[model samples]
Target: MSARRPIPGLGAAPSTDLPVLLPFDRGKGRTPDIYLATRWLASLPPWTPLLILAVMLAWPLVAHAQGRYAYSDAFDALFRWMPFLVFEGFFFNILISFLAMAIGTVAGAALGLAQISLNPMLRRAAWFITQLFRNSPWLVLLFIVLLAFPFEIVIGGVIIPIPDWMKAVFGLSLPIMANISEVVRGAVQSVPTAQWEASESLAFTRRQTMWQIILPQCFKRMIPPWMNWYAILTMATPLCSLLGVEELITLSRQAMEGEDNHPELLVPFFGFALVIFFMYCYPIARATIWLERKYSVKL
Candidate 1:
């Protein structure tokens, strides 16, 4: 090779990767922002820990003082007390919500499948149920459930004696089931015709194509939405307290006495509400994002 002659414009372009690895991003693979922040953090190592400590220490007081903490307080309190309470009040709530979601999911999928089903009765029934629940208000449905009967009214008065707790369960279930039916319907419908076609090529029943191929993938897409709705349900638990159920919000208010009447006591009680909310949600939010990144093909 000839001695390298100076070549105009031959200088190498700057590489994005740096010599130093980031603490949080070292095992996290590549993220340019993370690396940049890491380098900044490494250059001033003391600030990172100090800042985190400052944030943790400051969270409660900021809420007490009313500064850049209104949003923070809601979450901070949630993480702090959510564990002891969320599951406690909603021990039954989760059960009922999950059951409703399951029933709605199955029913919606059946209808979606029914749109392609061989049986006319199955198809008609699915559509009818969907339309009926869609037009009805969940709160009204819940009220109707509460007053329905000693023996639960099954369409056309089938002989099913419903328990009180089960009646509450049914009441909560109605709207949730209705909404989730639509969610599941959309998710099932979103699966490509190609995927269904491939499954069919393999001699899969429409049900088999849905269960094995479509629903699993559809569920992943459904998670963030489900978590959101689930949070809404948690917030709405106080409404159930209207029926004299002793839930967390009920307890928090019981402690508050009144927001306008008692400021000092309200702070602690408000703190109580904050604690309950964050305990369940903040971690779940963090974990949900982590899960989405970890499991999501698109991420």
Candidate 2:
């Protein structure tokens, strides 16, 4: 009250008052204020779809069993075959999809890095290869490989036809490689040019800077969309059935075609697909969460 506040630099931290302050910001974000109505709802996952599924399931009330198969009966049919559907149809496709995805990832990384190389001729060649594969329908690509590409491998003197399994691998890998190449190229390019310059100025070669400084950062940013694309490719693997690959959809169709099997195996088959994808993909999803947190990407 008597104008006795002349002491300086004692209230806030010293660095905040200093002109050349620490560059890092380690301060915690302010806690968000919660409103009464919305506080309890903030923690839920997106629930609209589940609510709709509940409504549909409730539509098949068994209180009015009309001596006929109700909607509940259909659900029951699905319930009976869930285990077999998961084992035969879901597991096989998931395995094949994982392998093909691994192949695509390796190919895409090489293709993308090649596209970004300083060598003009190498970039052009890589570009052409990627374009050719990307433009081709996966089914047609598989057919060409399966029907025309000589499946024979020449080892020493004897010629052995390439295993049909390898053929499917080749077919599945090509188009996925093309798509992944584009994704990788885009992700790599998305890094700011200044970052590259900063890295290079620090004495790193282009490859070293890209790998050691850039790629890890870019991929951390790219995971969500990248994972979404990978998920799509995983869904597409069943297309291998067209090429006679013994993957999930192929097995599911076979099971459905079995004697004494209800046609509704298709439903459980689809469910199995969903379950497998969700189960195995939780890691990627958690990875995505960690990436978003680590990189501070926008929600």
Model 2 residue 122 CA deviation in Å: 1.2
How well does model 1 score by local distance difference test? 0.56
Choose the strongest candidate by TM-score. Answer: 2
Instruction: State the lDDT of candidate 2 residue by residue for 170-205, as single tens digits.
Output: 777887788778878878898889999998888999
Cα TM-score of candidate 1: 0.53
Write down the lDDT of every candidate, Cα atoms only.
0.56, 0.66
Question: Model 2 clash pairs?
Answer: 151-162
Off by over 4 Å in 2: 1-84, 157-161, 260-299
lDDT of 1 at 38: 23
- Model 1, C-alpha of 279: deviation from truth (Å): 3.0
Model 1 agreement with the true structure over 98-161: per-residue lDDT tens digits: 6555555555555555654568897677667766876686667766877764655576766676
